[model samples]
Target: MSSSITTILTKKSYPPIGHYSQAFRANGHIWVSGQIAADADGNLLKRSMSEQAHQICKNTSKILQAAGSSLEKTVKVTVFATDFSKLPEFNSVYNTYFPQKPPRSAAEVSRLPLDVEVMMEVVALVDPGDEAKL
Candidate 1:
């Protein structure tokens, strides 16, 4: 059960607040960390739920690219929302990212770091040759 592990890093994505990589690659999979509505510069986007969701998804996309993957290759996704009432808004924005319907789960959390409205993370297949595109 020996597998090589690699930490994915990219300046085009937001820096991890703690001791964690934006994503990890091992055993043919890429596991991205939870992404909030923040840009690569770490500036939080404090806008409407739809906007926040869009930013979160965009952040995920960037991390996926940096990890030698893409949204189309995503196998699973988990979304954390502070307000269940805004699920529709979140879904509306999320649909634009995964129109093909990748497996996903959404949960209403008590709160998220920085008190953001939405956060998302994803798991996708790793394509080693895709690294240069990022």
Candidate 2:
């Protein structure tokens, strides 16, 4: 038996700088790639932790949308940050996107692509009817 995999992309989000889809949909789930604070053109942004978190969420949202999912459907999220002390700042913005507060794990890392302060990846359910359209 074989399954179909859909590559998700959106011009509204930061273009992938590397050879990877923004997200992939398969088996009723959308796996969004780790997103950083970058603009649509892929220029990394210099912003406060809260602002960066918001941008990352927005970028993730666009990718999810392209995959026929949304942040509200997110099941899991993993965050990597260069500073733990700014977690409060990141959470403040994160709560706005995920009011239900899906399961999440976070860790302080030494560095990330482009040295952005934070990067986030998500896994979300594919909307029932939307999957057939893929």
Best by lDDT: 2
lDDT of 2 at 15: 85
On residues 45-129, what C-alpha lDDT tens digit does candidate 2 reach at each position?
A: 8989888988999999988888888999999999999999999999999999999899999999999988788999999998667
Return the TM-score for each candidate structure: 0.91, 0.95
Off by over 4 Å in 1: 128-134
Clashing pairs in 1: none
lDDT of each: 0.85, 0.90
